[model samples]
Target: MGHSRFRRSIVHVNATLARVVGDEEGMSTAEYAIGTIAAAAFGAILYTVVTGDNIVSALTGIIGKALNTSVG
Candidate 1:
């Protein structure tokens, strides 16, 4: 009895999975290409900003202060 029940449950699960996966859709290659380009452009801009003098100096100051803090 348990063995037959297990077989029926597995069959039902497979049918449900097939139905769900058959109807699902996702982005194609062109969309992926556009997303990749956008991400690279954003990374370039972020790198330029972070490497600028003002941000560098600010980060240096913060790290210096943290390192110089006294402990009891």
Candidate 2:
């Protein structure tokens, strides 16, 4: 019957999904890779913000003053 076929198809799809994603023991590498990529993206954004023009200019001024004071 069509109903039986549909049920079997659903079951087959579920089984395939489970096999692909249910192996938690072997998923740590994938999890770590994802975490590392996320962390890197976050770090890039943070670095950009910290190194923006205003912050860079402030740091440059401070260092210039310090250097001038030390030299003169």
Candidate 3:
């Protein structure tokens, strides 16, 4: 009786583990949603930085300085 009970417990544990492993539904969708939101937020930040006056002025200044250099 003790041996039979131990075997039954092991079978039950295995079945539970199998069910958990098989239940990977919608995980990819959740990951994609999170990735998309992160990308959008990053894009927004970059757009703001690039469109700001300071960054534009700095870029223009760099280009002007580069163009004004005289090569011997």
Candidate 4:
């Protein structure tokens, strides 16, 4: 009788814990939010890699040429 009661109590505790863990009220939303933040960070890094310093230098040179041509 004592062993059976102990086993039943353990089973009950396990079931309750499983129920709480399986309840997904906020887990999916948090996952999506994290994914969005990661994607934005990746995009910013890619943009910096692709066009940052070169684009700035190119624009600066074009502006300098335009000013020199127009003034002289």
Query: Which residue pairs collide in model 3, if any?
Result: none
Q: Score each candidate by Cα lDDT.
A: 0.65, 0.64, 0.65, 0.62
Ranking by TM-score: 3, 1, 2, 4
lDDT of 3 by residue, 4-30 (tens): 774575565556545544566755666
- For TM-score, the strongest prediction is 3
What is the clash count for each candidate, in the order shown? 0, 0, 0, 0
lDDT of 4 by residue, 1-72 (tens): 255774575565556445545565766666556555655655665566457687689889999898889543
What is candidate 2's lDDT per residue for 1-72, written digit by digit as tens?
255774575565556545545665766676656645655655665576578897799999999898889543
RMSD of 3: 20.8
TM-scores, all candidates, are 0.53, 0.47, 0.56, 0.36
Minimum summed lDDT over a 10-residue window in model 4 is located at 12-21
* Model 1 agreement with the true structure over 1-72: per-residue lDDT tens digits: 255774575565556545544554785666556556655655665576679898899999999999999998
Better of 2 and 3 by lDDT: 3
